[model samples]
Target: MPEIKRQHGKQLFLITNTKQNCAFYRKNKFQQFSHKIHLLNRQPLENWSFVRTLS
Candidate 1:
């Protein structure tokens, strides 16, 4: 889990690279406001990339 600094409020975001969800978004996927989905081709202006990492 990670906290994204936004102008509105603090947004809790996560990156999911499950193979089952590959068709969902080719690049990045995120949520906005409540349960809305935000599919992004590139990453936002932040200190993170939309790449998968071993945890």
Candidate 2:
């Protein structure tokens, strides 16, 4: 992740469905960027987008 930040100097974006993992990222300073429902194989799933800015 640091490598990406060093290369881009932009906010990091992540998408995931695991609640536990998302909570972990939130605790570590990532902010909730978005929340949406995504369809996968004809079923709807809750997804979260997180962002971390590098200074």
Measured by TM-score, the strongest candidate is 2
Per-residue CA lDDT of model 1 for 1-55, tens digit only, reads: 2322333344334444343444343344432222234456764322221332322
- lDDT of model 1 at residue 49? 19
Each prediction's RMSD over C-alphas, in Å, is 12.4, 1.8
Worst 10 residues of 1 by lDDT: 45-54
After superposition, the stretches of candidate 2 with alpha carbons farther than 4 Å from their true spots are 39-42
Which candidate leads the pack in lDDT? 2
Candidate 2, 19: how far from true, in Å? Answer: 0.9
Collision pairs in model 2: none
TM-score of 2: 0.75
What TM-score would every model get versus the actual structure?
0.20, 0.75
TM-score of 1: 0.20
In terms of lDDT, model 1 sits at 0.36
Candidate 2: tens digits of C-alpha lDDT, residues 1-55: 7898779767787888888889898997899988899889989988899998877
